[model samples]
Target: MKIAILVEGATERAFKKKLCEFLQSHLGQKMPRLHFITQDGPIPKERKLKKLVETLLDNNGYHAVIALTDVYTGKPDFKDANDAKEKMRIWVDNNPNFYPHTASHDFEAWLLPYWTTIQKLAKHNLSAPSGSGSPETVNHQKPPSYWIKEIFRTGKRGKDYNKVIDGMAILKNNDLMIAINACPELKAFVYRIISLCEEDKIIS
Candidate 1:
């Protein structure tokens, strides 16, 4: 099946390379046949993304189109995220067969498959010593525990209230994933997407 992939921002082409690697190794496909569309930056205020997707759907010989947008949970980025989701919903309403997925945060598509693992790795990063004086080392950790607790807000049932739980579930269901600024551990996310596609015969 022909699939169309689109991203909201410009990222190092490494992501596409990784995606291609995934397809070749697992799906027996090449990059030339992949339909890729990328925006220069965050989506526009007027939501031009709708037109872009519509054009791709109208012209491309794709069997399915996956729209991927990064999460902007705050201020301007938040607005962009909400707008993008709304546009996709509208598009889906108009075209029932099209599939669109949005990530709760940037790089979530990459981080999702190994949710439990990523959570542990993030915790380890948080536990590491800050000033080891290694130029190659940069801190990459989840927000403080207090912050997580606050977001989840322990009610009758422990921290299971984490809002991110829903976001992760959404990622797990996607047939295709597009991640921007994904760290190394995120390869599992791509693998998971590939695995699901193969299982459901979405890719041959």
Candidate 2:
């Protein structure tokens, strides 16, 4: 299926890659045109992720547009982000084609607790050492490993905890996981294509 994804910044590169890998593993056949629309709007992040998805989409060509991004909490504890998300919701609702699907970490913290636990590394005496890791590592370096260890100690994945973050949390918590999962434009297109395909199957 051909799909377009718009994300806020490129922090979720690993997550995106995992998603594509999941899609490939599940579909068996290659996916068509997975477009990642970002700020540069030309290249979709440096990693081979762009080329891999592009080639896959070119061959199979499913139609869908997905957007992904965090809650964009602009201020301490993401207060401004909350307001910004509201504005974005209004825009999405008013838009002609794009549909907004989202998730909030606060509620979905159970979904991806890594965000919070990672931040606690400093408190656990696992602070980053000076000039050891790569520059990018330094830039995005999270708290020490102890934090993650602690969180994982509780459980792995939201499923184990009887929680489901599946983009529904966005409706109330202003999350963006849903938008990221299904590109609004691309989703509409995919739904249409699937419908048509089903119709053809029935007639044929």
Best candidate, lDDT: 1
Residue 80 miss distance in model 1 (angstroms): 12
How good is model 2 by TM-score?
0.37
Each candidate's lDDT (Cα)? Answer: 0.44, 0.34
- Quote the lDDT for 164 in model 1: 43
Q: How do the residues 161-180 of candidate 2 rate in per-residue lDDT, one tens digit apiece? A: 21222222212232333432
Instruction: Please give each candidate's TM-score.
Output: 0.47, 0.37
Candidate 2 residue-wise lDDT at 100:
31
Candidate 1, position 203, lDDT = 34
- Pick the TM-score winner: 1
- Model 2 Cα shift for residue 117 (angstroms): 12
In candidate 1, how many Å is residue 181 off?
17
lDDT of 2: 0.34
lDDT of 1 by residue, 67-150 (tens): 665554234444443565666667546465354554444543343333344334234222222321221122223322222333
